[model samples]
Every structure is written in structure tokens, then in C-alpha cells.
Target: MDRKKAAILALSLLTIISTDTVAPLVKQISASYPQVSSTMVKLTITLPSLLMIFFGLIAGQLVKVISKKAILAIGLVLYSIGGIAAGWSESFPGHLILRGLVGAGTGLISPIITSLIADYYQGKERADMVGYTFAISHFAAVITPPLAAYLGAEDWRKAFIIFSIVPLVFLFTMIFLPGTARRVQSDAAEKRKAPIPTKAIQFALIALVMMIIFFIVITDLPYLIETKTGISPIVSAFGLSTCTLGATIAGLTFSQIYVRLKKWAIPTSLLACGLGFLLITFSGTSVLILGGLLCIGMGIGILISLIMLVTANSAGEADSTAAVALVNGGFSIGIFISPFFYANLPRIELGLPAVEFNFLLAGVLFAAAGVIALLVAISTNKQLNLPHR
Candidate 1:
């Protein structure tokens, strides 16, 4: 591939990395600002999702008015500024506001990733690219937490400096990403808008559930380990990193999985996560927790790729960006709401410990989702095989 395409793909990886830049530092930040609620601290990682939800939709529509490259370039600048400024804030509330700016930047850039790929590629190549995008994005996940943990170890504020990379990406994007989205826009508009398929929404809802489950593990992980196992936050960061490694493996092999399993791939991934979380519920050692996290990550990796593909394929060229934006918005909503949702779940009467009980509840729900996906796949297969009059 040429430098231009590589640059575009790199943007996809950057988006995921930027979102979690503060994740490893969440515990440190919360400790630094004891006056703030734990839920508010977690919002440092999730609050961006609120803007991402709004801007994702708005960005999709803006494709009609501005070039994707231009929006992307401007977003990169905002992301860099917000990420760096958050570190300088003396107040937690001030930091939260800066993170929102970072999220606004992400919202502008995120939806365009799929749209750009859709604009530039098609058919089997497109599918392959989608899988590769997930692989690379998960590969970033594999590296980011440990890196953030290391940086945060010195000072939580230093971790925010990682956002400086945004400027480099911005420079590459401005120079390499093509200027022809304008022409593509005209062509896309000429094509009649098709209704987004119902399957897209169904897949998105499942993705939303998967994201919520995934975030539950991440958002609670440091405190859960500290409170239950007396482990260091660094250990939880490594455990989370292990999950990303699992996701990286899944992402790299997803096309092959898709070829053999076809419609079964999504459910199979979900099942892996469900089983993983269940294992974590009973985990007696760090090893078991790491193993469970791996399963969850692997499943989430595949689900994300599958959902993006479904949304992009289900809509017309013109609507593909908006469709993808909507799906992404659903995932962002899940992230934003995860802390509160888990907080409100009725505690089980079982003898399980608090964190263990939460994992058990999440495990059962994820497993149920997998079962439903399987049934839906089978029913759809049968319907497809039936003869039409």
C-alpha cells in the first residue's frame, strides 16, 4: 500500500488510542482529586463519549458540506490542544472540560474512517481492509495501557502528553489524505439513498451491549483489584493490556474466522467474552483474571469489526457514513452510561464478593446476548434457504 492509504488507516488506530489515553491514569487522577466522586473520575475516560455521540452524527452530515480531509485536519488540532491542556488544569472539573474537547475532535474524525474506506475500496478488498483496521486498532490497545501506566507512574499529568502525537498525525493527514472527497460527495449524492437495513441496527444494539460489558471491566478494574485483591494499579494495567493482546490476535485472524464461521463469527466472539467474564467472577489468582480479560478482548475485537462492516454495507454509498456514525454513536452511548448502569444493578444475594458479583451479573448478560445472536443467525440462515414463490 502507498503512504496515503497507510496514513488513512493510521487515523483509525489513532482514534482508539486517543480515547483511552487517560484510562490508565484514571485511578491516579481520582486519588489526586479525592473531592470528586469515583463516577466523576471515570468520566475522564467516558465523558468524551457524550460529545463523540453528538459530533459523530454531525460529522456525517458535514461530509456533504466539507471535505473529510479538512474535518479530519481540524479535529486533529483540537484533539492535540485538548489533550495537552487537560494536564495543565488545576481543577478536576477543568480537566474534564478539556477531555470533552478531545472527544469533540474524536467525534469529527471517527465517522470519516469508515466513510473514507468505503470511498476508496470495495468488495473483498473492502472486507479485508475492515478486518485489518480492527487488527491495527487493537494492536494500539495492546500497547497504550502499559505505556500510559508507565507515564502515569511518574505523574498522571505526563500521561496526557501522549496526545502530542496528534499533531504528527495531523501533518501526515493534511499532506497525504486525498482532496477528492468533494467529487466523491457529488457522486454519492447522485445515488439514491437507501434505507439502512434493520440488521445493521440489530448488530449495533448487540455491539452496544458488548461495549457496556467491556467498559464495565475496564472502568472498575483498578478499584476492583485494589479493593478485592490488594493489587497495584499497575497490575490491573497489565491485565487490561493482556485483554488487548487477545483482541489483537482476534483482529489479525478475523477474516479467516469470518470465512469459516460466516454468520456464526459474531456470536462465537460474544460467547468467548461471556465465558471470560464468568471465569473472572471466580478468579482466585491474577492469572485467572488475565485469562478472562483476554477472552473479553478477543470477543470485543471481532464484534467491533463485524458491526462496522455490517453498517457500512447495509447503507448506500451516500448513507454509509451516517450509518456508521449512528452505530459508533451507540457504542459511545454505552461507554458514557456504563458506570451508572453497573452502579444501579441490584446486588445478587449470592455469597460472591462485590466485584465478583458484578462480574457474574455481566457474564450472564453477555452469555445471554451470545445465545440470542446465535438464534438470530440460525433463523436468518433458514429464511435465506427457503424457496421464494
Candidate 2:
């Protein structure tokens, strides 16, 4: 509500842009480094994701030892350096390592974004702030991919330069974020005793599933368009931007949606995801694919916000950061695994050129996940409504 909180939220959104910065450059990087296989090129996108899987949890634990602000400062430094150096690196191996550093840096900051909000805000304000963060993330996505594509069109290295601005974001955060670090003392008995809630665990699992479903589309969309439709990266950028637009809409309207749907919010989101994937899988042209991707983005937009809200609300304040870290880590794991799943799986004999069998499978999986989420929502609703004997 105040300048400080607003600053933290804005700075936190900067971190969101980092996650997808390299996506548009994937094709160019692959072309630039022909020595590596396509799969290895894809790893450039997922490698940082893999590090986030471990570092997210490590960050949670590290918060007990160091200030979240300090960790974030360090992360921004790594992120800026990695992003800047990546543009200059000639060796493929060196580029990969820089990518990993960027991921590690992101891992440190990602968990704290929501946790800081949870720590600072409460009740309706907390929920609204959470939605705002998702909206900010989507808005950043809308800007970032297209810009990366434009720059990458000239030279893939140009895309990495965008990451250098992150240090400016760090400066703003240091100046504006309030100094309120929680340091747990060495006395075991006096330590914070909050337990991770069951709902948080469930949300973490849901985050994992949703992330896999969401990122498969993200990681594959550009390549799929280039390989199938013979479109340029700019066109692919537009399609992805359309998807982010859908997410932006969802993020902006999340409060109304959450108020209306309540406990069914996540299930409704999951259904949207399923529908989106279906549209994408069966789409005949890039326009139709954009439509499908929009649907997918809307689902993810709502799902991600709701999951963060649930995870943050479930934990007591003492454990909020750790709870967030666990969920982030789960999402990271999903991100790490998505590329591999698509790469290694044998193509289906679906007679459809340019249509991946994996997309079809992904559609089915999303639909099934939606159904399961719906059933679980109903069951949980019933349990909550039951009278005491």
C-alpha cells in the first residue's frame, strides 16, 4: 500500500522477466552453436530451471541465516553478470554455465517475492498483492518475449543484454524495500515453530503439475512454429505475447475471479488450461495456435496466482518463506523435467505434420488434471461444510 511495498512488488516483478528472457533466443542460440544438438540447445532454457529446483529450497533455509534482502541483492548481481556475459561468450559450454548462474540467482529471489508480500500484507490486502504480482509477471512476460525476439532476430546475443537492467532493479529494491529481516537465533527452543500446512503441500504438488503443463508449451511453441509453419521468431513472439496477454487479463482480473470462484478457483483454472491445450493441439494455423495459447495462458495465470495465495496463506508467518520456497522448488523441478519429456519421447504416428504427438498427450494430461482438481475441490468443499457430530 505504501511506497516501500509498492517498490518491493515492482522489483519482484523484474525477477519474473528473467525466467523467460532466453526463450526467444533459443533458436538463434541453437543456430549459433551448431556443434550442440537441439536438445542441448533447449537445455539453455531448462538448465537455470534445474538449478532453481535446488536453490529455491536452499534459499528458504538460507533466509534463516541471512537477510532476504541481502540474498536478493546477491541474486541480482549474479543475474546481471550472467545475462551480460552470456551475450559475449563464444563457447557453448561457457554459455551453459552462465545460464546456470542466472538460474541460481533466480532461485534465490523467486521464493522471496511472494513470501515478502505475505510477510508484509495480510487478509484481503495479501490476496490482492498476490494477484498483483501475477499480473506484474504477466505484464513483464508480454514485454520481455517480444523484445527478446526482436533483438534475437538481429543477433541472439543481443537478447542477453536485457538482463543487465536487473541490477537497476536491485538498486530500486535496496532503496525502497523496508529493512525488516527476521533472523532466527541459534537457540533451538526459541526458534519459530510454524509447521508447513497440508494445504501448502497440496498447492506445491499442483504448482508442479501446472508448471510442467505450462512450460512445455512455452519451451516448444517457438520451435514448433519455425519447424512447422516456416514463420520467423518475431511471429512466434507475437503468438507467445498473445498468450501472455491472456495471462495478463487473468492476473488483472484475478481478484474478481477468486471472489466469485472461491475454493473452486484452481479447478476452474485447470479446466481452462485443458481447453487451451486442446485448442493448440488441434489448431490448423498460427492464428488458431495463438487462440489456444491464450487459453493456456489464462489458465496458468489464474492457477499460478491462486497457488501462491494458497501456499502463503496456509503457512504461519514464521514458515511462510519456507512454504513459498517449497512450492517454487516444485515448480522448478517441473520446469527442469518438461524439456526432457518432450525431447526423448518417440513421435506418435498421428499423420498430422507439425503437430507434435506430445501436444496431444499434454492436452489429455491437462484435461485429466482438471477433472481431478475439480473432484478434489468438491471433496474438500464437502469436508469443510460437514457438521460436527
Candidate 3:
């Protein structure tokens, strides 16, 4: 890959990894924020993207006036700072604001990466990068929880400190990145901008909905394993790790999977995930729930990889940053809304330290998103009428 393309992939993966690294520290964070409710704590983790949804396009639109590399670097800086702040914060509101800053940085970096990658790579390479990015992100997801546990045990602050350093790694990547991919203020780019691909936007929306399912499985299901079934925190984290591990494997070959199956992959994976969720909801056995979670995790790996593939291809540009943004934006938005599903679940019983509902309603969302993904594919494929030859 070209330097610019490599930078885009590296930067995008960094943002993805950084966002989830805090998961293991949420409990520690809540302990310090004595006045913050659980909902607020959840927001501390989730609300940053609410800001991101509004401004994801701003950094890229400023491409003519600013360097894409600079914007990405700045975003990484914000992410690292916010992470550090979360670790150090004593007040609920302060952590909330810093997390938003972190989200903004994540929001800013992805579109530029999308735009740069589409601009620099093409066809299978572009698709492959999308999958690889997912794989790397999943790799982060796998490492972060265990790492966070170690760091948090040492000092919850260390978890955030660990992420503060991750962004610095990308600075070297920026140095190696080529700079030709900037929008360059050409009249041609301006004109072509008017007819943004509808299918790309469609894929983006699909990402948002599909990801509701992903989060439901990842974020919500573990609570169910812990509260509903009484699994220990350490065991729960390991079980959740199953999802990340699956994502890593699936993403490594996402382009090939996309070419072989296209949109069909989403529904197929969802079906598997849905079955797992159902099994967990009813079963008390740790082994059974773990197996179900494994299926859910592996299926989601395939599902999300497919979503990224569809978005990248639908845009039809090697440097289609907007396309990537659209999907990421959808993803961010889905994350923001996912907490509602957990509202109806069971609670930590009297004198018992635990969470309620096991995020069962969240599973309902996963099942629903799966159904919608299938419908979207069937309907849009017919509408687009892609080439028969």
C-alpha cells in the first residue's frame, strides 16, 4: 500500500481501538464520580459520539484549507487527552466533557481516513483495507479489556494513560504518509461532490442499524451473563473477549467474504447471533452462555465486516472518506441509542453487587437489526439492479 493509504488504515484503526479501551475501566470511573448515576456513567462512555454525529463532515470539508494528516493527528491528540482526563477526573461533569472531546476526535479522524483510503486504493485493495481495519480494531478490542483490568488494578488512571500513548504511535505514521490525497480545491472534485452516491449513504445507514446489534451483543450481553446468571466480573470479561477474537479473524478476510456473499453475510451472521442471544436469555449454564456468546461474536465479526465492505464499494471511490464517515457516523449514532434497550432488564438485587436485565432488550434489538439488514439487502439489491454480467 501507498504511504497515504497506510496512514489512513493506521489512523482509522487507532481511533477504533482507543474508543473501546476504556470499557474495563467504567466501573472504576463510576466509583470516583460519587454523584453520577449509572445512566450518566453510561453517557460518559457513550455521549461523545452525539457530538461526533453532528460534526463528522466538518474536518473533511475543510480539507482544501487544512491538511488531512493534521486533522487526524489533532483528533488523536483529543482522543488521548480525553482518555487521560477520564482516568484523572474527579467530577462527573468533567469526565463527561472529556469523553465528548474524545468522541469528537474519533469522529474527526475516521472520515479523513475513509476519504484518503478511497482516494489512494482501489477495488479489492480498498475492500481488503476495510476488512483489515476491522481486524485491527478487533485486535484492540481483544487486548484492551485484559490490559485495562491490569491497569485498573494498578490504578484506574493507568488504563487511560495506556491509551494516551497509543495516539503517539500514529504521529510517526503521519510522517511517513503521502500528502497528495488532499481535496486540492479542484473544480472537478467540487462538481463530482454534488452527486454523492445514494448506495453509499444506504450502506452507512445500514451500518448504524447493524451496529446497534453489534453493541447490543458486546456491551449489553455481558451484563446479562453477570446479573442474570451470576457470572463473575473476570469470567464475564473473558466471555466478552470471544466477540473481539471472532471479529479479528473475520475482518482479516472480509473482502473475500464480501465478494463471495455481498449483503447476504449480514443476515446470515445475525441469524447465528440471534440464536446465541436466545440461548443465553434462557440458559443458566456458563458454558452454554459462553458458547452462545461465541456464536454471537463470530457472527458479528462477519456482519460488521460486510457492512464496511458494502459502504466502501457503494461509494465507488478509492479515497471515499465521506463513505467511510457515513458508516462510522451511523455506527456512532447507533451506539448513542443502544443504552435504551438495557433499561428494562433486571437489576442488581438487594445487597448484591451486580447489574440488571442482562441487556435482554438489547438482544431484541440485535434480532431486529438482523431482520432489517436482510430486508435492506433484498430491497436495495432489487432497486440498484446491479449488473447481471
Best-fitting candidate, measured by lDDT?
1
Across 1-389, the per-residue lDDT of candidate 2 in tens digits comes to 67667766666666556667777787788889888988788888888888887788888787777788888888888888887797789999998899888888888888888878776777767777777878887788788888888887788888777886787888888888867643334563434466667877887787777677678777887655644653444456687777888888898888778877776776777787888788776665766677788888888888787778778877753647778888887888788788776667776677854336667778888888789978888877442211111
Which has the better lDDT: candidate 1, or candidate 3?
1
lDDT digits (tens) for residues 262-380 of candidate 3? 65776767777777777677677777777776777677777776666556556543345566676777888877776664554467554533232344444566677679878888887
Candidate No. with top TM-score: 1
Relative to the true structure, how large is the alpha-carbon lDDT of every model? 0.77, 0.76, 0.66
In model 2, pairs of residues that clash are none
Q: Model 3, stretches more than 4 Å misplaced?
A: 1-6, 182-192, 228-234, 317-319, 344-359, 362-389
Q: What lDDT would candidate 3 get against the real structure?
A: 0.66
Best-first order by TM-score = 1, 2, 3
Model 3: residue 360 alpha-carbon error in angstroms: 3.9
Candidate 1, residues 1-389, lDDT tens digits: the string is: 87657877788777777666677788789889999988888898898887888888888777767777888987888788888899889998899899998889988888888877777777666676777877787787678778888887978888777777788888888888788752254555555355556866786686676677678777777656765564444457687778778877877777677677777886898899899888777766777778888898888887787778767877655557677878888899889888888887788688866677787888898899899989999888532111111
Question: How far does residue 338 in candidate 3 sit from its true spot (Å)?
Answer: 1.2
Clashing pairs in 1: none
Q: What is the lDDT of residue 82 in candidate 2?
A: 82
What stretches of model 1 exceed 4 Å from their correct place?
182-197, 227-235, 376-389
